[model samples]
Target: MSFYFNIATDKTVTADQILEALGRPEVSVDDNKMIFHIPGKSLRGACVYHSDEGYEVGVNAFTPKTDARLTRDVAAAIAWLTGASVVPEDSEDSFSPEYIADYGGEDWVAERFDEAYFLARRPDDAAEGGPLSVAGYKRTFAVTPDMFEQDAGSLEDAIRAVMQVGIDLQTLDDREDIFAASLMSFTPPAAPPQSTLRRMFGLSKPVSNVREPYTAFFIGPDVRTLTPYNETSDPFYVHLSVDQKAVFRLPADDFFAYAEAAGARAYGAQVYDITISQADHAKLMQQAEPA
Candidate 1:
């Protein structure tokens, strides 16, 4: 792994000054971020940190300059060297009200996180038969700050971009059978304002024919609940199969609590915030596979 030093200054500061301050004179500069070589993993985002006022530093698993590697360390180094604090940056303010509002609020921003995080919580196919047939799919979009702003600042559009990007990549890989062979990274570019998401893969519309116990989740204002019959079930669970030997049978509330905890454990991960219905629960349990 490589090491780096970064300094964020409200007032301009030179790269040489930063290295001198850190007592490491042999540092190299890259783009806005800088780098240095340490014996092993050192000064990574997870291990090295500076306050909002000071510089942040870290070591990354990837080549800090390339998408091939990203880690807590790289995040730190970037924040420090570029003088760009991580979005929702502070640990103390990790799950704060502002934090939740920016990411977990109603609209598209919240939805993407909801799918990556909250949605992933619903039980997976932890059964004996193939992956316990959870029959629903997630929509991902490739979004940017500008695109989000243009959609009347609706986060839903951003979410759509991610879904679109994911779909496109999925299709390319499926059709070419080359997705698995490349040592490339699929970092979706930041969505542009008034941007159009090109569909990559998956059904353009919901696949009604493959009906299964399913649930849907979204980030929106007003705690919208999902009823079994409601056309728009926020988190509607789908039932498709059953597991004879269930490992952990948790109540709905407990299940959600577990999911929340799991989401908190992941850094730089998106979690969706939404409500579900009792009917959705029934569907989720319909094909219950215990791990």
Candidate 2:
């Protein structure tokens, strides 16, 4: 099987242009993606290195029926292919044995077809037995395109054709059996305040009652800003102050929306207790009642 690499980059240049940029020959570009034929006789299986946002790097595979998810196996394979350091702590070594036991086995696949194919096609000799790590190969070099034909037969020529696009290379780690590319770039838009907090903790803010002020709280790290939800509203972000004081600038009047949506038990919602460090609490108190 022939190995190919498809890079979905953050640029609009064609494959030929990428080749030209990289000063390589024998590569074809179809729109944004560039496919390359890697060197090696036996076509090893493919892997995927994906980030939270941005492009996903898929290894060339003999068939598309492969899982090729961002997992440990994929990370290891990509590290081997790219000559990047596949840190032991980034692959299967990072997974706890007890955690694996909870899920039946470490390499267990839910799909029968996947299980069978992986077992048969896995590169047995290539498998790293000890703590997995990425090793460097000398032959690998960054390349650009040249005035080469669309169809190049030589593997070296083809690899040289695969230009490095603007896809930021993040830390390469293995998740389960696939390689995960933790892309360093590609930032998504920030969500709304209530939604953001809800998603983070999977909980809702407590309602503000006349008897008790709704404690809008945030603890830990530098507090960016507590801007009002609206332009007209006062800066009511008085949950905690920089001095770690628990302050309530505004009363809590809303509740049940998030709790209802989260499907939290009645008892669970009632007994909700969020703990913070003494230092943080003091900071809030200082902010709550300024001299």
Candidate 3:
């Protein structure tokens, strides 16, 4: 199923203004309505129309295929343009396994189901000195079995519930343990048999033998900050750093290529590209563990 969100604001905005906010050119504009399209991304089309209550900005279709962060970015942009709070539409209930399978791949959705089941079955209170009770208080959390049923709505609700709990348990200063747990559970897809070219290029090495993939969290910069770098004439690559030491330079095209090749997926509120096998992921997790 597709997703949708609405922005209700009292500020006056025009079609051109909306397009400008999205950094897209207006495709068509009537007296009361304007349409814009994003060429290649999940955000396909959007329309801004005048309304009595306020201006309404609606997206064409948003689904698992769409970048999850795009919704929030769009809402923020609309709010900025109209000077009003953008009320996002909640279509989480409408998300189904069938839709996710159709758009995001069956294996991807199945893994989520497995994770939900695992989390649901875990005990609310851990054993003494266990991870959950380290802070000296018993933690209570459980997911109902109904969430794991072979239905779309239940699965969606269960996923959302689990994600919400995970988010709530996270602290700003600490590492995201919930996200690490999810990463540890991932099983990489079986790679194709090495071909002559792959053998020549030594493409069969374990991911650990290659450059270790690191998670770079980008905050403080809005979407607009990337606009100049994204321009076709002067596109720039991403340079990553840790503790002021330059780690690597990621070519713009290679970023998506690695993700697609490795079946890398993003998790949590912040975008994270998990580009390593379960073993490698576990290794990273161990490194990040408190001494």
All candidates in order of TM-score, best leading? 3, 1, 2
lDDT per residue as tens, model 2, 107-211 = 332331233233223354533331111111111111112212246475333322221110111011111222221111112234335667676897966533323
lDDT of 2: 0.28
Instruction: Residues 1-291, candidate 1: write the lDDT tens digits.
Output: 323233344534454554454443433333243433321211221223445554444432211121112223334334444545453332423232223324322352232234432222324342222111111111122222332234354454544443333333322323442212111111223433331333345324332343233332221112232211213223332222223233212233344453365342210112222333445444445434331
Q: Lowest-lDDT window of 10 residues in candidate 2?
A: 165-174
Each model's lDDT? 0.31, 0.28, 0.37
Clash counts for all predictions? 41, 37, 0
Residue 145, model 3: Cα distance from true site in angstroms:
30
TM-score of each: 0.18, 0.17, 0.26
Which scores greater on TM-score, model 1 or model 2? 1
Q: Please give the ranking of all candidate structures by lDDT, highest first, separated by commas.
A: 3, 1, 2
RMSD of each candidate?
21.9, 23.4, 18.7
Worst 10 residues of 1 by lDDT: 130-139
| Tens-digit lDDT track of model 3 for 1-291 | 223345555677665665566563523233343434333232223445566776554433212222233333444556676556544354333222223223334543343235334444445453222222101011122233333345456655655554443333322113332222111111223445666787789876543323333223221111111101121223323333333242333444454454455554322221233434445333333333211
